[model samples]
Target: MAESDGQERTEQPTEQRLRQAREKGQIPRSKELGTAAVLLSAAAALLMLGDALGEALSMVFEQSFRLERAAIFDPATMMPALAEAIGGLMWPLLGMFAVVLVAALVGNSLLGGFNFSTQAMMPKFSRLSPVNGLKRMFGVQALVELLKSIAKVVFIATIAIWLLWSQFDHILRLSGETLNLAMKDALELLLWMGLALCLALLPIVAIDVPFQVWNHTRQLKMTLQEVKDEYKNTEGKPEVKSRIRRLQQEMANRRMMAEVPTADVVVVNPTHFSVALRYDKDKPGAAPVVVAKGLDEVALKIREVAREYQVPVISSPALARAVYFSTKLDREIPDGLFVAVAQILAYVFQLNAWRKGQGNKPVPLKDDLPIPDEYRV
Candidate 1:
């Protein structure tokens, strides 16, 4: 088990961890499985093509040995004779090679799928250290591999002894048979023995496959701190995120405060809420847009900025609260509040006219204005 800063690694590796390990060529592998596949594949090919292979070998033997006296004496004839002999056996040999090649590929693919990592091929100076080499040679994984090898040798030897003992009578009878028949019987016996040996490897493969997978996972296990660090790297640190959010809020507030000067009127809910509105005289059909709206301290700040800019601050509790809650910044007030806001804008326009001596003083805006039921926040 691996550890981080005195903490034991017990957590399963994350997807990112596993992917990184794979990139470095750290993946589960079973030598037993690969060996079994090669042996079994070769045994199957031999079983299927044994007669054809035997006939080819026999033909090659006859050609090489049953030569004319003149041809045997001629060194120039030897190369052609060898070529003919090789051609006779080529197809059967090729068939066996093809089967073994396919088996090796399929067997290895069964476990870790397939990944080609160039990093695995890169040379590392750490691997050349004598201390590291000794550590690896005497490691827990090395011990396990040694035990498995010993067990395989013992198991296979026992199987071989038992097989020979059981087939003793048939082996002795082969010596008394004709050369052709004996060769055929020997080929058949070898094929059967190869199959039995391959079958004997299956139990080892079964044990080794799971052990390799488990060991690989164990090696990649993460400690508690490692998991937290990985999360921080992936999602970002909380303090940093908080700072970003605070900065973003500050920037937005500065922009909102900037809009306060341009507002036509700042409606206030006494001391609790404030909403700044601006009507575009150029677009007569457009409703007034709430350039800024805030609560509590922010509301006080809006009012302060409004006063500094000499903007009209209308004290309307119901209307301010309604607009504050219902209207978003930079959006037009809802259609339900259109009539009430129109009255306020008209009053402000009239008040400005009277101040400029262009019209008579307007009537005071009644606190209990025509606020619709749904628009009342």
Candidate 2:
């Protein structure tokens, strides 16, 4: 609901979750659309059957009733029954139409999934609002729809003419054929005609599906600033994020300093730098790492802590500063400092000899030790 730096948001989505869902096949597998398509083909087939059968059925029914010259044939008597029959047939016809609709829904499920809504049926006074009505009247959507309808009409008409002309001779020449042959021919003709209709419909599907997908995607797009706002809604404020980062750094520093008390030595600048190192013969691959380090005032505090804890202290000002600033805790000492550190370590071990009652504490500040300029940190 506010804004955020774009860093926290997803960039190129692999859409892996969506892909996995597809692999799992969670979407509806509907036959409704395909069934509707086939039923539409069947309806065309039925129309052909109806055209050929209507005359024969009417003749048979008339003769069976023997209503040659009677008032029973009169509209006055039969019209009411006819209306009653039409009324009686209406509900079943509606039920059948509902089946066709269900077939369409099933087909949609097969495509991927069926998404349904009834929002259009809500009681909306907006439908009656004059301002909205005028907007709809002149809208680009309305203009586009009008043009689409005209194009549809022209296209369907052209297809109808072409198909019917191609079948003209067969359709007109259906006299000598038996009823069985007639019905069979009609069905065959219907199948081919249905296929032609599908071919004709191909252009509409090809043009519309991709266009609809493109338009829908565009509708969902946000400006870069709007993208930031959405991220804020999902994540949190920038100040809170900054505070979190600060807490993490403080925790890491505290943890690093806390380990210094266990260190065997706290090498220092004697006033302004400190690096605490630890070694274990068990881990020979890594000689030592700076467990803790600090500068200036913090460096003095480290020296005080080392003294209070009675850990050995060695003064190497430049090395202490270099280790404090350049090296990270929990990592091996830098290559340039290794030899110098080893020599200091050797002296410290000899001092260890003095503390063990086998020798005496060596005097401090000897120039004889191989302390080099680059090794001064």
Please name the candidate that would achieve the greatest TM-score relative to the true structure.
1
> Cα lDDT for residue 240, model 2?
90
The C-alpha TM-scores of every prediction are: 0.65, 0.49
Would you give me the overall lDDT of model 2? 0.65
Give the per-residue lDDT of model 1 (tens digit) for 252-273: 9999999999999999997899
List ranges where model 2 is wrong by over 4 Å.
1-164, 167-210, 217-244, 270-272, 334-336, 358-377
Cα displacement (angstroms), candidate 2, residue 127, comes to: 11
RMSD to truth, every model: 7.9, 12.1
TM-score of 1: 0.65
The lDDT per prediction is: 0.92, 0.65
Measured with C-alpha atoms, the lDDT of residue 256 in candidate 1 is 100
